[model samples]
Target chain A: MSKTVLSTRGLRKTYGKRDSKFDALRGIAIDIHQGESVAIIGKSGSGKSTLMHLLALLDKPSRGEITLHNHPTANLKARQLNTIRNKEFGFVFQSFFMNSNDTVLNNVILPLKIAGVGYRERRRRAISALKTVGLDDKRNNKANDLSGGQKQRVCIARAIVNDPKIIFADEPTGNLDSATGEKIIDLLFRLNQEKGITLIIVTHDHELAAKCSRQINIKDGRIVADSANETLEAENDDKEEFKDNDMDDMLDHQHPTHHINVDEEEE
Target chain B: MRMLDVIYDANANLLRNKLRSFLTILAIFIGSFSIISTSAIQAGVNDFIDSQVDSYGGEGYLAVVSNDSFDALDGLQNGMGNNKTPIEYNPDKIQTGMSPLTNEQIEKIKKIDGIDGDSLAKEQTLDITYVTSEETDKKYLIAAEALPPGNVKVSLVTGKQLNLQADEYQILLEEKYVNALGYDNDNIIDKKVQLAVKDDYTHKIKTFAAKVVGVIAPSVVSMGYQYTNNKLADDIYQENIKYYPEDMKNKTYAVAVNYDYENYSADEIKDKLEEIGLSAMTVEDIIGTIKSFFDIILTVFRIFGYIALLAAAIGIINTLFMAVQERTREIGLDKALGMSSKRVFLSFSLEAIMLGFWGSVFGIILSVIIGNIANAVFHAPGGFLESFPTFHLVVYTMSDIISVTILIIIIAFLAGTLPARRAARKNPIDALRYE
Candidate 1:
C-alpha cells in the first residue's frame, strides 16, 4: 500500500557517434516500491553501472524519463540534480571514492556537509551511521589506511549518514574477498531491514542478487529478467511484521486510542 | 565553510612553497622600498633648501641696482624727495660703471604699494690697519659695507653695534678680525682702530681713527682675510667723523627691498624701480640659478632608483607566473567544487595582493634598517633613512605609506589577474584530470 519510491521508463544513454555509437543503457524500465532491496546483476559493460549512475542522478540519461519519489528528474537542472543527490539519494562506489585526505568520520559526514547541516548535528548523524555499519571505533582512521572491507564499511556508513530515501551502490563489494564481501552485503541488508531504506545495488555476484527481495538481470544494456526470490520474500514479510509492531508501540505511547471523528454539517 | 577556513587553507598552501613565496615578496618589497626611499630623500632635500632660503633673508626680498652713471647729488638723493630730475651722468664717475644706488632710490622703492621695507648700503674696497702696541701694524684690504647697524648681515659674538647715525667715530669689526688682533681683552667695545681713506679730490691716503664698538660674523665670508688665510678676523670698521664729508655721499650703492605680495609681484616692483630710472632683480632669480645646479644631481639619483624598481617589477611578474603554474591543480579543484570563475580570480588576485603587501612591508623595513646603519656609520642626519652625513633617515609619512601600500596591492592584483584568468578558463574536466 506504500508509495512507489522510484520509477524509470525507456531510459537510454548513448555514447559516441551514430556510426560507432554505444548504448550504455538501452530502453530500461523498472519500478521500485518503498522498503525494497533490489539487486541488479550483470557482467562487465552490461550498463549496470550506467543504470546506477542514472538512478543516483550522478549522470544524465541521453533519453527517456526517471521519476524518484514522484518527482520527474528528466528536465532537472544540474544544481537541482545535485540537491536531489544530496537530499534524496546516497551512493556507495566500488572503488571507495572517498577524499583520501579526509578521515573516516569526515568522509561519512561529507554528504551532510554538502547538504549544509550544522557541524554538531552532522557529527552526531555521521557517528550514528558509522555505528550502524559497526565502524564507530574506526571513525578517525584515514580512508586509505583502512583495509578493503573497512573502507567499504566506511562508504556504507557515508551512504546512510544523511538518512536518504534510497541508496544506490555500484559493485559494492567487487574488490573485496569473499569473507569481507559477505560481511559488507550483510551490513547493507541490515541497514535496509532496520532503517527501512530502499536499497538498490549493482553487482556481478548471482548469490548477492539471490539474497535481495527482487533481482533484475541486465545483458547488453537491457534488462532480460526481473524475478522475486521466495526466501527473500519471506524475510521481507518478517521485517514488515517487526516494523508494524514498532509502529503500533510508537502510536500507543504517543497517541493512545487513535480514532478520528469526522464532523459534517450542511451550510 | 567559514571565510577564515578558506584564508587559512590558502596561507597553508602558500607556506608549503616557502622559497617561491619569499622571492615574490622580496620583489614587491624592493619596488616599494625604492619609491619610499626616493620620496623621503626628495622631501629631505626640499626641507634643506627651504631652510637655506629662509636664512638668506626671506623669499620675498629683492636686491636692486642702477644701470645709469653716478653724479654727486644722485648718491645722496633720498627716494622720499620729490625731485624727479634725471641727472646727466658720466660713466667714469660711476664706481666701476656699477652706478651706486642712492638712499633716494631705496625710499622710492619703499613708497611702492607692495614694498614693506628697504635698506641702502655702500660697500668700498679700502686698506685697514690695526696698530699692535703702536709699532706692529697689520695691513689688509677689506671690503667694507656701510649698513645700518641693525641691517648688517652678520651676527656679533661680542661688543655693541656701531651707531650708524654717529658719523665715523664708531665701527663694527668682524669676529675673525678681533680674534686676529690678539687683543686678549674681553671688552674691546671702546677700542680704537685706524682706517685709511683715499680722498676723492686729493687722492691722498688719510688715516682715520674709529672705536671698535661691535663685532660681526658673516654667514658666508667671501673676499675676506679668512678666504686667503683660512683664519677668522674682525675687520668691519665704522668711518671716522673727521674724514667724513658731504661730497663723499655720492659713493652710496646697493639697495635691498623687502616686499609683500598683497599689493604687487616682484616683476611689478622691478618695473616700478625701472620707471624711476633704476634697474632691479628679484631673489627668485638668484635661487633659480642655484637650484638648477642641484636639479641635475637629483635627476641622476631618481633615475637610478627607477631602474631598481623596474627590476623588482620583473621579479614580481616572474614570481606570480610561477605561483600560477604551481597552483593549477588547486585552481581546478576549486572550480570543480562549484567555485565561480570570478571567485577563483578574486582568490588568486587576493593572494597576489597579500604577497605584494608583505613584500613592501619587508622591503621598507629592510631599507630603513640599512639606511639607519649607513647613517650611523656616516653620521647622516635628518632623512627618513638617515644615510647622509647631515640628514636623518627618510621616514615615510602616513599618506606615503598608504599610497605605497595601495600601489603594491594594485600591482600585485594586476600581476595575478592574467594567470588567474588563464586558470579559471581551464575546463573543469581537464583540470581535474591534471596530475
Candidate 2:
C-alpha cells in the first residue's frame, strides 16, 4: 500500500536522427515506492544508466511521462525541476565528481548552498554530514588530497547533507577496490536501513543487486528481468541473470564504439 | 544562496587562480592609469593658460583687428591689446580689417544692436607727454591713451578704479609710470599731474593740469601706458579742431562697442561682425580655443589607455572561457545541486566585475601617486597661470576617478557575458557526464 515516490510510464530516449538514430531507453514502465532499495542491473550497453538519469530529472525524457511525487514532470520548468532535485533527490556518480580545489567540508556543503541555506547553518550541517561519513577529521583537507575511498565518502556526505528522500547512485563503487567498494556499499545500505531513504543504484554486480530489495535487469534499452518478488538467494543462483549482468554480454551494444570515453564531453 | 555568498564564491574562484586573475587585472590598471595621467596633464596645462589669459586683460573684452586692406587703425588697436590676448603672437598678421576705422565707421558700429553705453570706446592718441606735477618739465614722453578708458580690465594696487567718465580732469597713473615719474610709494590720490599734448592732425600744443585719482597696478594689457579721462581730452580736441572742418573724422583709429552682455550670445556677436568683414572675439573665446586644443591632446592619450583596457577585456574573456572549460564538472555539479541558470550566469559575471574593479582601483591609485610625483617635479609654482594657474601639473578630481572606475567595470561586464552565457546554458546531464 506504500505510495510510489517516483514512476515512469512507457519512457523512451533517442539520440540523433534518420539512419543514425540510436535508442538509449525504450518503453520503460516502472514504479519506485518510498523507502525502497532498487538496483538496475545491466550489461555495459544496457539503458539502465540513461533510465536512471531520466528518473532523477537530470535529463528530459524523449517520450511518455515521469511522475515525481504524484506530479507529472513533463511540463515542469527547469527551475522547478531543479528545486525538486535540490530538495528531494541526491546523486552519486562512479567517478566521484567533486570540486577538487574546494575543502572537504565545502564540497559536502554544495547541496545546502544550492538550496539557499545560510552560511553558518550550511557549514554546521556540512560538518555533521562529514562526521556521518566518518570524514570529520579531514574536513579541512582539499578534495584532491583525499584518497579515492575518502572522496567517495565525501560524495556520500554531500549526497546526504540535505537529508534527501532519494539517492540515485550510478556505479558508486565502480572505481574502487573490493574492500573500499564494500565499505561504500555498506554505508549506502546503512543510510537506506537506518534513515529509511530510497536508494536506486545503476550497477552490473549481481551481488550488489541481490543486496537491494528489487532488481531490474536491462539489455539493449529493454527490461529483461524484474526481481521484485524474487528471493535474494534465487537471484544469486540464477545463471541467466548473472550472464545478463556480465560485462561481456554486450555483443549488440547500443552504445557507440567511442562511448566508453565519457571524458569526450569535455571537448 | 544569499547574494553575498554568490559574490563570496566568485571571489574564491579568483583566488583559486591567483596568477591568472592578477594578469587580467593588470590590463585594466594600464587603461585607467593612462586615463588619470592624461586628465592630470590637461588640468595642469589649462590652469597655466587660464592665468596667462587673465593677465592679458582678456576678460570680457574682445579684440578687433584689421584683416588685409589699408586698415592700419584696427591694426594699431590690436597692437595695443597684444599683451592681453591668449592667441599665439604673430606681429605680422592683423585679423580684422586693414582700413583705419574712421569716425563714420565708429558711428556705424555704435548703431549695431546691443551697443549698451554712450562711452562705447575711446581712440588712443600717441601725441602726448606726461610732465612733473609742476606742469613745466617734460617727465615721461609716452604714447598716452586719450579718452574715457572704458571696458579695460584694471586692478588697483592702492586706490580704487578711476572714474574715466567724470567731468573733472582726473588721471590714474600706471604703477610703473609712477616710479618713472619720480613719485614715492606714498598714495598718489588727489595728486595733480600735468599732460602736454601735441596733436599732429589738429595742429595744436596744449598742457593741462589733471588730478591723479589712483595709481593703477600692472595690467595684462600693458604697464607702460598712462590713463586719462576725456574731460581734459575733450578740451584739447575742441581747441585744436575748432576751425579745421574738412571731415576731421579721418584720424579715428579704433572703436570699442559696449553692449549689455546678457542680451546676446558671444558667438552671435562674433558672427554678426564677421558678416561685415570684421573680426570680434572675447578673452573667453580665445581661452576656449586653447582649452579645446589641449582637449584633443588629452583625448589622444586617453585612446592609448583605452587600448590597454581593450587588451584587459580580452584577457578577461579568455580567462573566463578557460575557467568554464576547466570547471566543466564543477559547473555540472553545481547545476545538479539546483543552481538556476540565472544564478550561474550572475556568479560568472560577478567574477569578471571583481577583476575589473580591482584593476581600476589599483590603476587609479597608482596614477594618482604618479601624478602627485609629477606635480612635484613639473609645477611652475607660485604663479603658473597668473590669472588662474592650475595649482598642480596633474589633478585627480573625485568625479573623474569614479567615472573611470565605473567605465572599466562596465567593459569588464561586456567581456564576461559570453562566458557567463556559456556556463549558464550548459546542460547539467551532459556537463556531469564530462570527465
Candidate 3:
C-alpha cells in the first residue's frame, strides 16, 4: 500500500563479449516500497549482487531502466548519479572496507567529507553517527585496532552518516558471528522501522531473509519465488528445478548444522 | 571535493610515505640548487661588470686605432695561438705591435659624422722610468696614462677625481702605489709624488713632481693602470719623445675619441670610422668578451641543472606511480563515496606541485645562505677578491628566484599528469576488487 521508492522493469546486465559473453541478470522487475525491508536471496553468482548494484545506482543496467521516485535514472549524468548516491543511499559491505590506519572518527566522516560538507558541521554529524553506533568513545582509536565487529559497526556508522533514504547492505553480517550479526541486523531493521527508510539486503541466509517483510528468491538469473505473493504453493509445481539440493550443498560446506536445520525445516 | 581538502589530502598522503616523498624531493632539490646557484653567480658577475662600466665613466668613449694597427694586433694573437705556418711578409700590412695612424687619417676621423672633434686626445705612450714620493726614498716602477675626457667618476678608495684641465700636475694613484709610496689612502690625497721619464736617445731620467689627487680601487676595467691629469701626461710624454726624429715624433698609434652616443649607436659610429681606414672599440666591446666568457660557463652549468631536473621529473613519475598502486583501495573507496574523477586527478597533481615547491624553496634558502657566506669569504683580507671590494661572489635577484620556482613547478605538474591520469582512469569496482 505504501508508495514505491524504487522500481525496476526488464532490468538486464551482461559481462564480457563474443566468446566469453555472459548474462548476470535477466528480466528482473521489482517494486520496493518505502520503509520495507526486502531481502534478495540467492547463492553466489545468482545475479543478486548485480541487482543490488543496479538498484543502488552504483551501476547502470546494460538494458532496461530503473526508476527512483518515479524519475527514470537512465538519462542522468555521472555527476548527478554520484550526488544521488551520496545523498540518497548508504552502503554496508561484508569486508568492512575502511581506511584502517585512520581514526574511527575520520573513517565515519568519509561520506560527509566527499559531499563537501563544512568541516565543523561534518565533524558534528560524524560524531553523532558514531554515537548512534555506540562507538563515540572509541572515535579517536585507529580503525585497525578495533575488533571485527567494532570495525563493521564503524562501517555502518560511515554508511548512515549522510542520513540516506535507503540502505543497501551486501552480506552486511557475513563476516561476523551470529551474536554480533544479530546486533547489526537489529540496528539496520530499527533504522528501517523508525526512520521509514527502505532496506534492500542481498543475502542467502534464510533466517535473515525470514525476518524481512518481503523476500525475493533468485536462482541463476531469474526470480523463482516471492514470499510477498501467494506463489509459494503455485510456484512449487516447478519444484523439480527449485529443489534445495544446490543451496543445501553450499550451506553444508560452510555450516554443517545449519544445513541439517535447513533441510529439516523445508521437509 | 573542495580545493582546500584536495591540497590537504595531498600533503597528508605525502606524509604517509615519508621516505619516498623525501627521496623524490631530494632529486628535485639537486636540480633546483644547481640552477639557482648558477643563476646567482651569473647575476653577481653581471652586477660587478655593470659597476666596472659605471666607474669607467660610462659609454660614448672609444679607443680608436688605424685599421693596419688593429689587424696587426689580431695577427699577433692568432700567430701566438693558432697560425703556425710562416707567412709571406707584406710591407703594406703592419704585422706586429701597432702601425701609427697618419695625420691624414686623423683629419678624416675628426670630420666623420657623430665624432666629437673636441673630445679627441692622442693616445700618448708615456715611457716613465720610475715613480717615487717625497715621503719614501724607494722608487717603484709604474705605468701612468692620461685620463680620458668625460665625467669620469672612478671607484676611489679615498680623495677626489683628477681635474683634467688643471695646469698643475695631478695623479690618481693605484691602491698598490698608495701603500708602496709610504702613504695610506687617507693621508696620500693632495700629497706630492714624482714620476721620472727616460729620454729615448740620451736615456736621461727627468723627474716631474705631481700632487696625488686620489687613490683608485683595483678593478678589472682599469687593469692596474694609474691615471694622471692632462698636464702631467703631456709633460711626461714630451720628455720621453724629446730625442725622436720629426717623422716618428708625429706618428700616433691610437686616439681616444668620444662620440655623440645619445644620437647614434656605437656600431653606427664604428661603421663610419671603418669607412675611413680606422677601427674603433667601445667600452662595451672591450668588456663584452668577459661577459660572454662567464655566460658560456654559466650556461653549461644551467644545462646540467636542467638535465638533473629531467631525471628528477622521472623520479616524480616513478614515485607517484608507486603511490597510485599502494592507494588503489583508498582511491576506490573515495570514488565510491562520490569524489569525482577530476578531483582525484587534481589531488595527485597537487602532490607533485607541492614536492616541487618545497624542493625549490629549500634550494633557494640554502643557496642564499651559502652564497652569502661565499661572498664574505671571497672579500675577506688576503682573499682573491679582496682587492675588488665592490664585487660580490653571488647575487640573487627576485625574478630569477621566481622563474626557477615556476619552472620546476611546471615540470613537476607535467610529470604528475601521467600518474594522475592513471589514478583517474581507475574503475571503482575493479580498484576495490584489487587485492
Candidate 4:
C-alpha cells in the first residue's frame, strides 16, 4: 500500500470584498496517492490553475490545510517552501517559462543547482534528463531559440532534472501543435510508467485528460467530478490484482524463513 | 552557494555598468589625493624648518636692544623724549638701559649650572674696497660686525679661519660676497683688501688693510637682520675683519647666549635676557613671520584642492544613487534568492569603497607629477612651509600611503552606504516590479 503523496482540505481563496468578491477556490478537498498520474480538466477561469498553484506551494490558500509527502505545509516559511519546491516537486508551465538568457543545459541544471547538488553531478543528471526529453542535441541552444515543442521539451527536462517525486505541469503542451502535444503527453506517460513519479497536470485538452488513469474536473472554484477513466478502469483493476498476487507470492516465500528464526530464538 | 559567490555575482552585475563605476572611483581618488598631498607638503616644510633651526644651534640665543631702540629716531631728534641727548652712532649708545655684561658677567653666567657660552658683537656701517682684478676695483662700504672668535661659529668652505690670538689683520668673507667679488678661493684667499671705517667722533674715513683669511657659507645667524642689513653694502664690504690687540676694543651692542638646559627653550632664553635687564627676541619670532607668509600661500592651495574634492564627492554620490535606481530589480532578485539585507548592503558598500580606492590611486599619481614639476620650477629654501627642489612636497612613505588608502576606502564606504541602505530596505515586490 503506497502512501498518499498530497492532500488538501477545506481550501478557500477569495479576492476583493464580500459584495465585489470573487472566490478563486472554494473549499476544495482532494487526495493524490503516490505514483498516480492525474489530470485536472476545466474551462478557462474554472479555478483549476489556482488549485494547481496552491498545491505547488506557489500560492497560499486563504483558509485550508495542505500536506505534501505527509509533511504539513501551512506553517512552512517561504524559504522552507522554496526548499521543498526545489527538492520534492517540479513544475512546468503553459508558456514553457524557460529563462531566456540561459542555455538549455543551464536551464535544466538550475533546479539541481538550487538543491545544492555538486556541479559535475548536476551536469550529468541534467544531460540525462535532456536525453529523456529527446533534446540532448539542443543542450547548448538558448531556450528562447527553441520552437514551441522544443521549448516545452526543455521545460520538461528542467522539471525532472532533480528527480523529484512529483511533477506539477500546467497546460504542459497547450502552446504546441496537436501532434507535438500528443508526443509530449506520451513522453510524460512513459516517464511516469518507468520511474513511478506522480504526475499532476492541469489542462483544458479533453483528449489529454481522457488518456490519464484518473481525471478530476473543477468548475467555479469547486470540484465537479473525480473518477477513473472509463477506458482504463478495467485495465487498472487488472494491474492492481496482479500486484496483489505478486505480493502474496513474496510473503508466502518468506513465511518459512520467519518460522525458522522463531524456532532458533526459542532454542 | 557560498557568500563569496554571492558577492562575485553581484560584482559581475555591477561590471555591466563600467562607466558609472569608473566615474565613482575617480571621485574618491580626487578626494583622497587632496588630503594626502596637503599633508605631505605640510610635513615636508616642517621637516625642512626643523633641520634649519637645529643647524642654527638649538633655540637658546636671543637678540637684545634698548627699549627705546624700538621707537623711531625721529622722536629723539624732536627733543620731546625722556633723554634729550643726540643718539650716538656708536654701538655702545644702544647699550644704555641694558644690563652691561662684561667678561666677568659671562663667567658668572657660565657657572650657573645650565648656562653655556655667550657671544657679544658690535656692528657699524663702513665703506670698503676689494680688487676683483689688478685693474678692476669695486667700492661700497658695507655693514660689518666685530665678533669674538671663540663665541661666534662660522662655517668656512674655503681659506683658513682667523687666529684669535694672532695680532694679524684678517677678514672672513660671506659666500654671497665671495660670489659677488667674482673671485674664487684661489684669488680671494691671502688677497689684500682695505676697509675705510668712518670714525663717529672724528667724522673721518680711517683706512685699514687686511688679508682674506677665510670664506664662510652664510649661516642663518650671520644672515640675521643685524648682520647683513644692506644687500649692496654686503657686496661692497666683501668681508668681516678681526681687529688686532693694539686696536681699541669694539664697543658692544647685542649679546647672544646659548643656555645648556635650564633655559634652553626660545621663550625661556628671552625671559632670562629680559630678567637680566635686556629685551630679547628669539629666532622663533623671525621664523614665525616667515611661517605666516607660507600659511597664506598654503591656504590658497588648500582652498582650491578642497573645491575640486567637493565636486568629486558630489559626483560620487550622484553615480551611486543612479546605480541603486538602475539595479532595483536585480536587488529584488537577490532578496528573492534569500540573501540578507545586510549582505546586499555590504556588496554595494564594498563596491563604493573600491571606487574610492582606485580614485585615490589615480589622483595621488597625478598629484605627484604635478608636485614634482612645481618643486623643480620653484627655487625657494625649504622651511616649515616652503617646499624646494631638493625637498619633495608629497613624501610617499609606506605608512603615509597606507593611511591614505585606508582613509579613502572608509570615505568611499560612507559615501556608498546611503544608497546601499536605501536599496536594501526597499520592498522586494516593489523593487522587482520597478521598471
Choose the strongest candidate by lDDT. Answer: 3
Interface quality of candidate 4 as DockQ: 0.08
TM-score of each: 0.54, 0.75, 0.88, 0.57
Order the candidates by DockQ, highest first — what do you get?
2, 3, 4, 1
Index of the highest-DockQ prediction: 2
Model 3 misplaced regions, further than 4 Å: A226-267, B73-85, B102-117, B259-277
Question: Which of the two, 1 or 2, has more lDDT?
Answer: 2
lDDT (Cα, tens digit) per residue for candidate 4, span B1-435:
444544554466456678877766666666667766776676666555554455444455555553445443543454666655665555544423433444544444444444454343333334443223232366643445443213344556677656544455567776555556667766788775565654334444555555667776544444522122223233333322233232233333455555554445555655655454445565556466655666677777666666666676666667778888877865654443334566678777767766776787887788777777666556454543242223454455666667777866676687778888987786544565476
- Give the lDDT of residue A5 in candidate 2: 95
Tens-digit lDDT string for candidate 1 (B338-374): 3456655666666777777787787677766775665
List, for all models, the DockQ compared with the true complex.
0.07, 0.62, 0.47, 0.08
Give candidate 1's TM-score: 0.54
Superior by TM-score: candidate 1 or candidate 4: 4
Structure candidate 3, residue pairs in collision: none
Candidate 4 lDDT: 0.64
Clashes of each: 30, 16, 0, 4
Off by over 4 Å in 4: A1-267, B1-11, B29-33, B54-178, B183-285, B288-325, B376-388, B397-400, B425-435
- Between candidates 3 and 4, name the one with more favorable lDDT: 3
Candidate 3 lDDT over residue span B1-435, tens digit each: 667888888898899899999999999998999999999999999999888888987688899998877677656665676767756677877788887888998988888899888889999877888999888999999987998877667888889988999999999988889899998977888889888888988987788999998989888888778999999999998898898887888889899988888999999999998888899998777888999999999999999999989999999999999999998988877887787888889999999999898888888888999999999998999888998889997999999999999999999999999999999988876777688
Query: Model 3 Cα displacement at B415 (Å)?
Result: 0.7
* Candidate 4, true inter-chain contacts retained: 0.02
lDDT of 2 by residue, A102-221 (tens): 899989998998889988999999999898899999999999999899999999999999999999999998999889999999999999999988999999877778899988988787
